[model samples]
Target: MNYEHVREVDPAVADALEGEVQRQNDTLAMIASENHVSEAVLEAQGSALTNKYAEGYPGERYYAGCEYADEVEELAIERAKELWGAEHVNVQPHSGTQANQGVYYAMLEPGDKILSLDLNHGGHLSHGHPANFTGQLYEVEQYEVDAETGYIDYDDLRDHAEAFEPDIIVSGYSAYPREVDFEAIQAAADAVDAYHLADIAHITGLVAAGVHANPVGTADFVTGSTHKTIRAGRGGIIMCDEAYADDIDPAVFPGGQGGPLMHNIAGKAVGFKEALEPQFEAYAEQTIENAKALGDQLQERGFSLVSGGTDNHLVLVDLRESHPDTTGKDAEEALEDVGVVLNANTVPGETRSPFNPSGIRAGTPALTTRGFDEGACREVADIIADVIDDYDDADVKAEAAERVQNLTDAHPLYE
Candidate 1:
């Protein structure tokens, strides 16, 4: 928080911050899980609140001199609850994965059955990948996308629910492009008397702005990242019915974590206030529109988009059909060479390893925040396709890089 002293002590860290700002100003950020927070949010994140250590919830702190910290946290909690229409909200979880873990801690015992979507089929790691704590501590049964349609198969999910008899059912993803059917997922959970949890980390902004359907009223627990689409600081939030507030709070505090980051909570308050503004609705709508436009443009250029297209802000490009000889890893590096940033992801039923998957994931939230619309999205798609088409050609890559620089310069991110 005290960058002046930091500069006096070590100029390297100060130089790193300046370099990061320059990098953000120069590059095109297309990663779905990333976004630019408002200056107000950043200010709150780097405020004097960082000096305090409020170790407990409001009206109940273990440390002294927490009155102001309690006020800031209470504002964040109230704003979050109001913004999401949640009965109860906890703004303490450090990340989305930790929020999911808190939900599990509140409800399920060790080795209890958990039904979640497969990671390769758009699910997140906390949804029970074997390498994650969720899978190691619980019995995990995974459902997958429909092979033909590349969408969730409700029948298959129901069948798995009946067979697995899970204690918890998770509905969410990191790379999925289509909107999830939360009502149907809730029904499936109810059919087996399982607790339904929805991780809306990627679409929290859309949900906040009412562009996407709300899952808070349907799911027993909902977890989200304040940073991604919400455009907040790097922290996680959990919302649930008031009846479960006590269990969830304790689960996050004593069960999973200790002292909360009051600085991040202050930033969360500012972000929630921004989301409640009328312009945030327009921003969310434009994000989806830009994504669809980009997807359409890519498809017109003969690129194979997984799930056909997107109903959200992200599109998953299946490189196998577009560039049969090139892996997504190659496409990712090729695009990055041209200043376009995106991640290589695994498509459903992908034969490639996770380390070097066969799909590229891109989104429009950060670009949209930077004032990009349908036309800019189309141009970006063209640049990305051009780079992929010339993956092996150094001359072509150089030309593409120059064009990318022009586009990025024309549309500065922060200015």
Candidate 2:
């Protein structure tokens, strides 16, 4: 695979790369929005196409000598449309936030009202966090999850839509664990005469594999990251009904971004091809199983889970009930010390600031891709609980680190 070729000229950079691989092999990756791509995807991303700068859509580029780039981009767009069953697709935006911005530019004017989920309550920053461009440009109204159930309350969302009279209703989240009822959200938007945009970035693979509800067909516009569960290169895609294709394309191109990353487009094409394989469906299903098993095991070990449990590939662990004195920051550090990687997140209604929240978010997609099953997940949860239980004691941390090393040795990722 020539993976070691980089070491020949720059041993320092090569050592860093090797060290990263070793870290991945030694740690349990549980970040919900992260996954490792296949070698083929990696190869495409690092291919010669990166040298090109085809500034426009396929066959209509601003620059000449883009025949190969045109072919690769066309393949990516076509494969993405077919995989998601969307009427039109634009595989250009550099990331999910950028994709959301493109959608906004396509459909609404600056200062238009947007009703979206609240950030601390599982919503993505692009959905309207005060710090993001979405919030700065748009008049944003945020809806929160029901405090008791930790689930979206459609009635409350409807109330917000009615009061805000928003031009767009955004349905999607970054940390939520339950299945999003797009139909309900759409209906609410319909009642308010607002456009519905579903940002299914985290669950795109499950939707493509038919393991989760497909929002592309129902939403007026659907935006997602190609990486996450889709296993594509790090990029974003915006799909919509054919009626808005022209507007979306222009918004993504000259309106918001310049030339597309042709190499990443090629990698996205490879990812779409992989998603079309029947085995992808099995992998998607197993991801959910592993997540549910992990959630149940953690709950059994006295860790409180938001939304009771997960119906998707990720879970939000509310750390307040489990470790009374330890915050999500403490848990994150302790887990890292034990060679398990996860992110601290804010639970719905959490009082802590975003920098140090009350929850930890974890997922099973990467681990399942590395061949772990439900039993393995159970063991992982037990270890996680043990680490959290003794986060302050140095001896406990050392013992947990040894156990993590043993688990990683047994699993042996990227082999």
Candidate 3:
């Protein structure tokens, strides 16, 4: 795990890298999009494959000596297929955003309509945020969760899809904490004759472990990031029925990117192999249990959860109702000072700037990776409430910092 070679060549970079490792070890990583990969995955991602330019798919290449690269890529594709149960899988997209781009390229013209969840309502930037390329290139409309219930209003989505008559309907989310009903969304897309793109970027590992319902067989296209719940180093994947294989392959390759990052694909392969073992299922189950426990503890302390609770890895806490005087950023900065890390996110019907939104999003994947269970997460919830309640008090922060240290010491990262 030590970067001795890097130290000899670039001590400055090595210092920063080692500093990051120490930071992760010391702090609580509750950020919903992150997870700590295994040391085997770390070694695979840092392997010599990084230097190879594997520009094409397995058994097909634009350069010489791609035999070994092909082998690695093939294993990643096969394992992904087994994990997600898609007839066709493309492991080449550089990210989940690029994976979405591949699907759009294959399915729509520049002006075609897209219907997706609203960004402030737990959707992703790549889905159709005005600042993102997808929003700029396509005519976009959005749906939202119920204002009172904090759950996706599937009926509204279905009605909106009919009115929009979009080229595609995007499901899945970034901040919403409930399990998705992919079948319901699929029915809506079918009625509108639109393609269904399920961006399960945050729940990839949950679906693989059978804790979350899979979108592969139901959605027309499924895209996800390998590093979130899955603990694969970092990359994106796309799955589809064999019917659209040709359209997708070209769209991802010459359509969006050039050479693939073989090392990242190798990390995905190793992580997927690790996930196939029996123990991974328990890990996935515990992640949800921890989230429920964390949210329950927060509720008992008077924090307002967006969905009342969660059925998945993360929970969205609306600071407006719980601590009206304190902004999400205020809590975020104070928590960081106490060595607790998470993100301030926009909640439904948000009134503040996205830079400093109304809610904080927390998750259990990273903590669970470090061996945290329900009891540890409940303790963390109390620490979070303490900071939010008295963010300016040094005594409170010091006490909370001590608690965070105790938790981190108990369930150490990268140990």
Candidate number of the best TM-score: 3
Between candidates 1 and 2, the one scoring higher on lDDT is: 1
TM-scores, one per candidate:
0.98, 0.97, 0.99
lDDT by residue (217-268, candidate 1, tens digit) is 9999999999999898789999999999989999999789999999999999
Candidate 2 local lDDT, 1-415, one digit each (tens): 2447788888888888888889998898999998988989998999999999999898899999999999988898889988999989999899998999999999999899999989888999999888999889999989999999999999989988998899999998899899999999999989989999999999999999998888887889999999999999889999999999888999999999998998898999999999999999999999999999999999999999999999999999998877767788889988998788999999988989789999999999998888888998998888888889878788877887887788778877667
Model 1 bad stretches (over 4 Å)? 1-5
Using lDDT as the measure, the top candidate is 3
- Candidate 2 wrong stretches, greater than 4 Å: 1-5
RMSD to the native, candidate 2? Answer: 1.3
- The local distance difference test score of model 1 is 0.91
Flag the better candidate by TM-score, 1 or 3: 3
Per-residue CA lDDT of model 3 for 308-355, tens digit only, reads 999999999999988988888888899999999999999999999999
Question: Per-prediction count of colliding residue pairs?
Answer: 0, 0, 0
